[model samples]
Target: MMLSEKYLQIRKHSEQICEPLEREDYVVQPIVDVSPPKWHLGHTTWFFETFILEAFLPGYQVYNPAYNYVFNSYYETIGNRVIRTDRGNLSRPGVKEIYQYRAYVDAAMLDLLKAPISPKAEELLLLGFHHEQQHQELLLTDIKYILGHNPLFPVYSTTAFKLHHDQTKEREMISIKAGIYEIGYSGTDFCFDNELGRHKVYLPEFSISSNLVTNAEYLEFINSGGYKNFTYWHAEGWDWININQISSPMYWHLIDGVWHTYTLAGLQPLAVQEALTHISYYEAYAYASWAKLRLPTEFEWEVAAKSFDWGQRWEWTESAYLPYPGFSKAAGAIGEYNGKFMVNQKVLRGASLATPEMHSRITYRNFFHPQLRWQFTGIRLAK
Candidate 1:
């Protein structure tokens, strides 16, 4: 696809994800981790304006000077902006205004792409495309969070998304022979900097499940008092469950002794056959402990990823979010993307249904705090 076409398609998809949302839904940030839908729309546009239009397009006019302060997300080098927690507090530059901002920037971005562009500008444009795609995934999940948390448990769209149903194949472990393996992104494609620095790691033979842990399987854990059993949980995970009174995965509810979960399609009976999602790394670890198994390391996951079907959920790995042997940050605000976030987070391999098309490479390293379960996270066992 042409660069301009790809840009428009991605930009449109972000807005399309929000089509079912009410104006009120756009401003909700139920938790510090979930940015409001409006914020995502504006922040993604600001990325293009700041990085591509302003930096590359000569005499390009910024749509709104104040948007830089409102939409700038965590580039310390990019100057001060709204903190994550306070994103929901702003009511001005409301949903309509945010959409207008998107249109304004989209026009300038298209104009810039019409002419031959320098390699640096093209690089930033591609990065901006993927960056917006990242936000597109967030937009859907955030919309789910906003609607799912409401007492009404309102539906975002009746047909837009369906929870992943259970795998039909019988569960089995796929054996991987022990060997030194090349890890990290090796392809000459657009990948985040964190996926670079390809290096080798030695691994012993291991077996990983061909299927993700299903809701029925997890329900067994719940019935067996998995949440109550501190033995299965890490010390910190145990504390998180207790302090937050977390008893089940996010959006899960036991109503009249039946399990139901909130989805974009609205509150519905939990399909035990479906792959489990909205789980934290802590939950994944504890569940693995209870099953007398362990989660795969990221390297093990990459090696075995081709052997099984994935992309149903973001599978948690038993690896910390750390840089590779030769990892180095790209200089400037872009450098702040992944390198600095390499602490206190766990690596999640594969991809979730919420992930955008062409965005789920095996080397993609998604990290989040261990206690966060808002994203579509799941588990696969290794031993």
Candidate 2:
């Protein structure tokens, strides 16, 4: 497909994800990490404007100059911006106005793409499309969180029933002998900067589960008093358990002894054979310990990934989110993308059901605070 067609398709998909949301659904921010569905719509549009239109399209009129202040996220180099937590507070732009802003920016983007593109312009444009795809995943997850926590427990879409279907793949462990191996993305296609500077790493012999931990398996952990036992949890994790009083995965409820969880399809019976999802790093770590196994390091995961199926859920790995060897940041605002986030975050390899097909690759490194369980996160055990 041509670059222009690809750009339009990606942009359309982002909007398609938001189609199920009600106007109210687009405005709520239940947690700091989860932006409003509408905010996601606008912020992605802001990215193309701030990076591509302003950078390359000379005489490109800014679509509401104030949006830069309202939508700019975490780019300290780009001048003063809204605090991350305040994204939900902006009520003036309204949902309809944001849609207008998106249409306005997308038209300019398509017109620019029609002409011969410079290497720099093409690079940023591709990055913008990839960036939108990241938010497409976020849009679904955030919408889930917004509805899941509501008193009404609203359904985002009926199609979410597809996620509850059981997987028939037999469970097995794939063993890898200890050895040095090449890791990280080396392909010529577009990849994030974090996947760059491919390098070699040594690993001890290990075995990894063929499938993600299922709801039935996690239920066993719960039935065995996994939450009650402190030994299964990290020091901080134990503290979190006591403070938050978490007994089950997020959105789960024990209604008269039946296990049910809120999904995009609304409340439904938990599928026991389906992969356990919406779990935190702390939970993943604790479950591995309970099973007398461990989470794979990012390098170990990369080496064995081809041998098993993934992309069902983002599997937590036993690795910090630091840059690979010889990694460097780009000079300006874009530099803030991945380099600065290396601290205090756990690495998750593989993609989730909500992840856009083009946005994820084998070397893609996803990170979040260990306690965050909002994304489509699950466990894959290693030993």
Candidate 3:
């Protein structure tokens, strides 16, 4: 496929995910990490304008100059912008305006892709698509978060990603032999900068669960007072639990002795056999402790991933989000992407159902703050 076609397809899918959303759903940011769906649309457009069209195309005009302040995320090298917590408060660039912004930028991007470009410009263009794909996943997740937390329990779309009950496979652990292994992306294909600089690491032999922790399994933890018992939680996790009064996973509700949670398909009975998702690192870690198991490090996960089925959920790892030994950031605003966020985050491996096709690879490292539970985060036991 041509580069222009790939770019259009990806950009179109981002819009499709929002098709089911009501006009009002596009402007909400329920938490600090989640950008409003409208913001995602605008910011992704801004990324192309800022990085590709404006940088690569001669005489490219930005659709809106003030949009820089509204859409600029944490890239301090770019310019000053809105702090995250106030995203929901911005109402000027309504949903309609954001869509126009997307159209405007999309035209310029396609025009740029029509002509041959330098290798470095092409690299940035590919990075822009992947970056949008990352936000596409975030778009779905943030949409879920916006709706799931509502008192109405509004369903975003019945067709959105959800699990069907599967009782055919028995849960088992896959044992991996200890060995030194190469980790990180080595291919010429597009990968985020963090995934570059492939290196070697030694992993002790460990057994990883063949399947993710199930809803029924997590139910056991809840019934056993998992949230109440400080022994099962880390010190900071314990504080988080107490302070937030969290008794179950983010969307869970116990209604008249029945377990149900809000989903893209709406509030429904929790599927016991389905993998438990929408969990945080703290919850995953605490549940691991409760089960007397451990979460695999990212390296260990890559080493054993082929032996079992994954990609249903973003499995949290027991690793911190850090760079490889020889990793270095590029010299400009693009350089600020992943390297800056290395400090205070936990890594998740595998891909979620919302993850776009070709967007994830085994070596891809996804990181989030420990307290966030809005994404499709799950656990795979290792010991």
Candidate 4:
């Protein structure tokens, strides 16, 4: 696809995800981790304007000078902006204004793409495409969180969104022979800087499940008092469980002695056979402990990924979110993307149903603070 076409398609999809939402829904940030839908739309637009149009397109006027303060997210080098927790507090720009901002920047971006561009501009354009795609996934998940938390338990869409369910596949462990393995991105395609720095690592023989853990399987742990048992949890995880009174996965409810889960399609009976999701790294680790197994490290996951079906959920790995042997940050604001976030997070391999088309690769290293359960996260066992 042409660069301009790809840009338009991705930009459009972000809006389509919000079609079912009410104006009120676009302004909420329910938690510090979940940015309001309006913020995502504007932030993504600001990325193109700041990085591409401002840098590459001469004579282009920024849509709003104040928008940079409103939309800039976590690029310390980009100057001061709104702190994350306060995103929902602003109501001035509003949803309609944000949409207009998107349209304004989209025009300039397409115009820039029409002409022959330098390699640096092309690189930032691709980065913008993928960056928006990343927020596209977040847009859906954040929408889910916004609606799912409401007392109404409203349905975002009946048919517009659906998660992949893995149930019929028989559970089995796929054995991987122990050997030294090359890990990290080795392809010519676009990948985040974190996936760079290809290196080798030695691994002992191990076995990983061919399928993800299912709702029914997880129920066994919960019924056995998995959440109540600190033996299965790490010290910090145990502390988190007690401090937050966390009992089940996010969006899960036990009603009238039966389990139900909130989905984009609305609240529905828990499908025991479906692959479990919305789990945290802590929950994954505890569940693996209860099952007398362990989660795969990211390297083990990459080496064994081809042997099994993945991408149903973001599978939690035992690996910490660390840089590779030769990892280095790119200079400037772009460099701040992944390198700064290497600490106190766990790596999640594979992709989730919420992930955008062509957005994920096996070498993709997704990290989140271990306690977050808002995303479509799951687990696969290794031993």
Better of 1 and 2 by lDDT: 1
Collision pairs in model 1 = none
Tens-digit per-residue lDDT, 111-173, candidate 3: 887888889888988888899999999998888888888899987777655544343488788
For candidate 2, the per-residue lDDT at 7 reads: 88
Query: What C-alpha lDDT do the candidate models reach, one value each?
Result: 0.91, 0.89, 0.89, 0.93
Model 2 alpha-carbon miss at residue 16, Å: 0.9
- Could you tell me which residue pairs clash in candidate 3? none
Candidate 1: list runs displaced more than 4 Å: none
Q: For residues 245-285, write the lDDT of model 2, one tens digit per residue.
A: 99899988998999999988888888888889999999999
The candidates, ranked best first by TM-score, are: 4, 1, 2, 3
- In model 3, which regions exceed 4 Å deviation? 160-167
What is the lDDT for 48 in model 2? 95
The worst-scoring run of ten residues by lDDT in candidate 3 lies at 159-168
Pitting candidate 1 against candidate 2, the one with the higher TM-score is: 1
lDDT, residue 219, model 2: 93
- Superior by lDDT: candidate 1 or candidate 3: 1
How far residue 17's Cα lies from its native spot in candidate 3, in Å, is 0.8
